[model samples]
Target chain A: MKNKTNTKKGLVKAAFMSFIVVLFLTTTNCSSDGTQIVANFTEIVMQDEFNTEGAPNNALWTYDVGTGDNGWGNNELQYYTDRTENVKVENGYLLITANEEEYNGSSYTSSRLLTNGLFDQQYGRFEARIRLPYGQGMWPAFWLLGENCDEVIWPQCGEIDIMEYRGQEPTKVHGSVHGPGYSGGEAITKTYTLENDRFDTGFHVFGIEWTPDYINYYVDDKLYNQITPADVTGEWVFNQPFYIIINLAVGGSFVGSPNAETVFPQTMLIDYVRVYKN
Target chain B: MKNSKNLYLKKISVVMAILLTTVISCERELSEDAVFAEFGSNAEIYTDAPVGLTDQFFTSFDPNQGANTQGFGTDNNEAYLGSSSIRIDVPQPNDPDGGFIGGIFLDRGQGRNLTGYDALTFWAKGSTTAIIEAGFGTDFSEDKFVVGTKNVVLSTDWRKIIIPIPDESKLIQEKGMFLFSAGTQSTGGVGYTFWMDELKFEKLGTIAQPRPSIFNGEDVVQTAFLGAPVPVTGLTETFNLGSGVNQTVNVAPSYFTFKSSDTNIALVSERGVVTIVGIGSAVITASINGVPAEGSLTVNSGGNFDLAPTPTRDPGTVISIYSDHYTNVPVDFYNGFWEPFQTTESADFIANGDNILGYTNFNFVGNQFANPTVDATVKSNLHLNMYIPDNIPANLDFLISVVDFGADGVDGGTDDLRQQIFFNSSDFVADEWSTLEIPLTLANRSHIGLIIYENVNGSPLTDFYLDNIYFYE
Candidate 1:
C-alpha cells in the first residue's frame, strides 16, 4: 500500500511540471503574433501582409516628383518610382532598397511611399512594425506629415517621425517631431533600443499615442517621449490632419551621407500597421 | 507589567516630539516673508514712488505700489529697483504662461508721440541676461520701438543702460513710455530677474542732417542701346531728336562698336539698360565721326547705373536724392527695395501692371531684413527712402536733411531726413540716373554716400523721377 502511494505522489509532481512548461511556452510564443497590441492606433497599413502582392489595390500610396529640390524640403534625390524594381513584393514582404546609379543629374536612388491621399487622421494611436537595415549611412524613417501641404509647406506642416534609424548608430532608433518653432536643425528627438541585439535582427514595432494635450512615443509598448503642444511658442502643428510616409534616404545634411562602409539593398520588413481611435 | 508601562511612556514621548517639530517647521515656512523684511538690518529699503510725474512712469511690477500684484507667491523687494530710480521686480513666477510677468512701463495715454524727442534712456539691473525694451504703442502690434538688449551676469549689484535712439526723425512721435522688463518670451518662456528704477528721459540732442546735391554735372550715356546679342563692335549708336515735322526718319547709328582694349568694365544688358559690373574706368567711346561728338563714362567700385526716366514729382518739392515727395524709380535693381518705405511692415502687395520691362514691379517692395534691431511698437525704425532722378549739369552741390513733421502723439504727420554726398563727373555720368542702394548691407547703420559737388553750389531746375527705393540688404 505504501509503494502505491509513492507512485501516485510522483505522478502528481510530474503532471505539475508539465503544466508549468506548457504555460511558459504558450505565453512566450503567443506574444510574437503582434497580439501584444502595443498602443492603440488610429490607422495603419501593415506591409507584411503585402509580401505576396504589393499592398492590395495599392491601398496606401501617393507618388511625388517633378518639383525637384523644392519638392519635400528639396533634400532627396529620387523620382519616387512606382516600378517594382524600386519597391517590390518578394518573399512575402515589401522591400525598399536604395540603389547607387545615375538618374537625371541626381545619383543614387530609392522609393518613398505615402498614405497622404489615401488616409488621414487627427489624433489617436499610431504604430508600425519595421525591421531596419544596417550599414554606415542609410537613413530609414517611418514618419507622418501634415496633409495640408498646399496651405503650409513642410516643417510648418508638422512631422512626427515614429522610427528613424540611421545606420551609423546601428543599434538605436530615434523618434522626433519637426514643426514651426522647432524644425530642421531645431527638431526634438529621443532614442531607444531593444532588450537584446540591435533592432536589425528582426522586426520590431514602433508607435506613438497622439492626443490633444500630449504626444507619447513608444517602442513596442515602452513609452519613451512626451511633448505637449503648449510647450512650444509656435502654433500647434499636431492639431490638423496628418498622413504616414516611409522611405530610405541616401545622404542628407541631418543624416550624414552614406559611406563605403554602408551596404546597399537593405530592406525594412514591416509586419503590420493597425490603428485604433479613442 | 512595569516593563510594558515603560514602553508605552517611551512611545508617547516620541510621538509628542514628532508633532512639535512638524508644527514648528510649518509655521516658520509660512512666516518667511515677515522674517525677510526684518532680518537684514544693514539692508536698505526704498519706498515706491511714481516716476515721470505726469504718470508717464508707472511701476506695474511692484506689488507695494498697488498698481499690480505679483502672482505665484512673489513679494516686493526694494533690491529690484535700478539706481536711476526705476522700480524693479525679481519675480519667481512658476508656471509656464502662468507666472507674474513683471516690468516697469511708461504710458502715453493710448500712444505717445515722440515728435520732438531726440533719444531714449533707462537704467537696468541684469539678473541673468535681461532686456530694456521700450515700446511706443498701447497695443503690441504695429508699433515701432527699440529694444536695447543686455547680457547681464547675475550679481547683488546694479548697472545703468543707455540706448541711442537711431533715426529720431522717425521715432519721436512715440506715444509710449519706456519698458523696463524681464521674463520676455525668449527666456524659454519662463521667468528671469531684472531690476530697474529711476526712469528718466532726457533729450540728448538732435541728429544733424548731411548736406545734399553732391552731383557733379556730367551726363552718363549708355554707349550700348537695348538689343539682341551681337558680335563685338568698336562704335556705339546715338539717337537723334527730329527737328522738323518731316524729320521722322532722321536716323542715327543704331549700334556702337566697343573697343575690346577698354574691357575693364563688363557691360550686361537687361532689357535696354546697360549695367556696369566693374571697378575701373572703361572708355565707352561712341564717336559720330561726321559730327565729331564724344561723351565719356566712368564706372566706380561696386556700383550700378539706371538709364530709365525718373518719376514725375510735385513741381515745388525740392527734387534731390532724398526727396520724399517723389516715388522710387520705375525699376528696382535689387529685389525688395520698396520694403522700407511702406507704412505696414507686412510683405503684402499687389503685382501691378506690367512694366515696359518684362519684370513684375509690385507697387510695394517685399520684406527686407526679416529681423530688425529696433523697437517694433512705438515707431517703425523705418528710414523711408525714395529714388530720385536728377539732371546732370557741369557740377552742383545740394543740401539733404532728415526731418519729421508729425503729431506729438497718435495723429499722423510727416518726418523726413536726407544724407548728403557729392557727385562729380569722376563719380557719376549724367543724362542717365544713378541708383544708390541705401543701408548698403544688412547692417543697422550703413554707408550713405553723396556726390557733394565740391565745385558747383546751386540746385538745378531739371526734373528727375525717383521710384522703387528701400533699405538694401
Candidate 2:
C-alpha cells in the first residue's frame, strides 16, 4: 500500500466525521461492559451479506492466486487459489476454506480476496461479522491496506488490521496498525478476549471506526482499543484511501506451522461485511 | 541530508522485514478442556468409596485357582482424587494358596444404566510399573458382555486410563461396575501394589473418531461351505483423542451390527457370526452408530456340505482330539498361526447344528495339543474322517505328521520325535466322507503334542473337511 500525503486530507475527514456524528446520533445503547455506544455511522456505502450464491461479487472482489514470492514474504505454506473449494458464497455466508491438499507443489490451499481496485475508501467504519475456524496454523484476517501500494513499499503505504486471529486461541483476536517504523513485531496492536465463548463456535463482529485523528477497535459491540498518532512510534501514515482484504492463511511467519492434531479443511465464515461512511 | 535519510529508511525496512519473518510468530496456548458428554445416571462408581454400591462391592475370584482375597482395600495415603483409593496387593507366584490378585466389584442392586456413558475412566499408579487386565460388563454369572483390556501398563506417576465401552447402548442395566485381574506376569512373578482412584464411567466426548474393525480392518476373502458358519475375529475400536493420541481397545463383536450384502447367500448375526447359506458370494460388513467400520469378511460359498462319516469307535477306548461322541482332551489351538511361510487359514465353523473343523485356503495347517500333551501310549491307532469338497486334485497326497516331545514335554527340544505318513491321491474319495484309519507308528506316543495335515512332496491338496479325530485301540 502506497499513498502520498494530501494537503487537505486531515481537514476534509475531520469535518465530514463530525458532521456524521451530529447527523447519526439517534441511537444510544449500553454494551456488555456498560459502556455507552452511540450510533456513529449509519449510511452503508458498500455491503455484502453474502446473500448471493456461487463466487464472490466480481465487481467488488478480486483474487490473489498462487503462492506469492516466498509465501507473500512471510513463508506461508498454502497456495492462494480462487477455486470454489477454497472460497465461496453459500447459505448466506462467505466461506474462506483452508484445505489440506497438494496443489501447485504446496501442501495446503486457501483463498485471499481483495477490493483494491473496485472499492477504496478514505475514512469510514468497516466491519465484518465472522465466525473463525480453529486449530494451529490458521490465520484469518479482515484488514485494509493503502490502494497506492505499488507506488510505495509496505510500512510506508500503511496497513490497518481490524481483526487478526490465531486459530489455536479460539477466544481472542488482535487489532493492529503498521507504518514506517512501527511495523511487524513493533506494530501498535491490542487484543480482545471473549469470556466463556470462542470465536469459532459463534459469529462475532470485528470492526474499526476510523476518523481523521484516531482509529477505534471493536469486537462485537464493545469498543476495545484506540490508536492515534501519539501511539505510533514511527511516521503516522493513515491519511490515505485503503482497500479491504479478507483472507484465511495457513502456516505463515505469523502463525507458525500446523501440527498433526490440526484437522484439515478449516473454514472461516463471514455472515456479512458492511462498510459505512458519512 | 535527503539522500542519507532515504538510505537509512531502506536499512530499517530490511531490518524490520527480518523481524516480521522470525519473531512476529507467537502462539497463545490454550488449557486442556476435557469435555464430558452429558448423560443421566449415577456415573460415579468410586470417588473415595464405591459410589451407589452396597457395603461390600468386591467379589474375589475363585480361591481354588490362587486368588488372594485379603489383599484388596482402600488406602487413604494415596489418591488421585478425594482422600482414599482402591489399593490392591498382587501376591507372588509362591504365595501360599494365593498366587495372584483379581476380583469384580459387583452391584448389590440392579445393574447400572450405562447407555449414557462411553468409557470407564480411572487414575492408576503401580508400586512397580506392572501391567494388568481390567474391564466391566460381567456379573460372574453370564459374562455375556465381558470386555477385557489385556496388559494395561500402569505408570509410576498417576495416569488416567480410559477403557472405552464397545457399545454402551447394549448396557441398559449392567451389573458389573468394575473388574480387574492384576497378576505378576510382567514383574517376573514378584508381588506388587497398585492403587486406583476416581474409578467411574464417563461420557468423554474427546474419545472420538471411532474406527471399529473386524479381521483387523482387512478385507479377508475365503471359500466357505454351506451350513458352516464362521465367527468373526479381531474385534477392536480405535479413537483419536483430543490430544491427538490414538487409543485402541479390544471390543466385543456384539457392539457391531453385522451385515451381509446378499442375505440369501450368507447371513451375519449381531454376534458377527457369518453363516454360508447359499452357493454365492456375499460380503460381510459391520457398523456402529451408523459409522461403517473398516474391516470386512467376503465369503464365497461352495454349494453344499457332505457330512463326515461318523466314527464307530467306543468312547471308553478313544482319546479324542476332536469328536462329538467322546470327551476331547485339553488342546492348545486348532492353528498355531506360524507366520512367514504359512498360507493355511483356520476358519473352523459350526455346520449342520454342530461344530466342524472347516479348513479353507487349505494349504497346510496344524492342530496343536501341547497345552496338555496327550499320553496316547495305551492307544493303538489314529482315526480321522476327511471329506474332500469339489473335484479332487490329481495329486491329492495329504501328509499327516505326529510330534512327541520326550522328557522335556516341549516342541523344538533335543528329545522331540516326529513321524510323517502320507496318504496318496488314491486314498481320497471326492465329495464324500473318507474314514481313514492309520496305525500308530511314532517311536514315542507317550507325549504326543501336535498333529499336522499338510500337502508335501509336490501334492496339491487345497480344500477339505475334518471330523471325529481320535486315537482308539
Tens-digit lDDT track of model 2 for B261-354: 9989998877778888888899999987777888898888887776676677778999999987788998888877664367777767666766
Of the true interface contacts, the fraction found in model 2 is 0.00
Q: DockQ of every model listed?
A: 0.03, 0.02
Candidate 2's docking class is incorrect
Give fnat, all candidates. Answer: 0.00, 0.00
10 residues in a row with least lDDT, candidate 2 chain B? B30-39
Q: How many residue pairs clash in all the candidates, one count each? A: 94, 3
lDDT of model 2 at residue B203? 81
Task: Estimate how well candidate 1 is docked, as a DockQ score.
Answer: 0.03
lDDT of 1 by residue, B30-92 (tens): 432232111111101121454332343344445432222442122244332321233334444
Q: Please write out the lDDT profile of model 2 over residues A1-278, one tens digit for every residue.
A: 01212324566789899878854542332332323333377789999999999999999999999999999888899999999999999999999999999998999999999998999998889999999987788999999998888799998999999999887776779999999999999999998987645677678999988877788899997887878889999898899899999999999999889998687899999999999987
